[model samples]
Target: MEDKRADVQELSDFELYVYETVAEIDKAGGAANIETLRNLIDRPEEDIWAALSHLVSANHVHSTAKGFTLGPHDWAP
Candidate 1:
């Protein structure tokens, strides 16, 4: 069977930070707002939002009226 886990594609340090940020937020049982993620990742607001947007487009994250959360497809082994 094809692995249902998310592939750990080669990623830059910043991209990996984004991935970890999403996972952290999920584990914390809270949503990650752009501002909150920015603070957590120690990145600029624009960069954080951009990363979040990329994650959203890649089906790794979902945006709700409140903020962002892991998407249905974001399963890691």
Candidate 2:
């Protein structure tokens, strides 16, 4: 059997926060732009940008016309 668990990666606290922010955006029936995400996370804009960049690259998050969103990997039921 394939070990699916091994394919999962760990997220740093900030990265997890960034991902969760995007998830909340999904929950609210909308997306979040960088400014809105910044306000929600209360971190330096640069840091948020960094985390978002990484998330996007990893396919854990995605970018939308409105802002950021959870990538397919993080999609929920």
Q: Which predicted model would earn the best lDDT?
A: 2
Give, for candidate 2, the lowest lDDT window spanning 10 residues. 1-10
RMSD of 1: 3.8
TM-score of 1: 0.72
Per-residue lDDT over 8-39 for candidate 2, one digit per residue giving the tens place of the 0 to 100 score: 25668888888888888877888879888878
Please give the distance, in angstroms, between residue 75's alpha carbon in candidate 2 and its true position after superposition: 6.1
Q: Quick one: how many clashes does candidate 2 have?
A: 0
lDDT of 1 by residue, 1-77 (tens): 43243444744567668877877887788888877886777767887877776677666677888788777653563
Candidate 1 has an lDDT of 0.71
TM, every model:
0.72, 0.79
Clashing pairs in 1: none
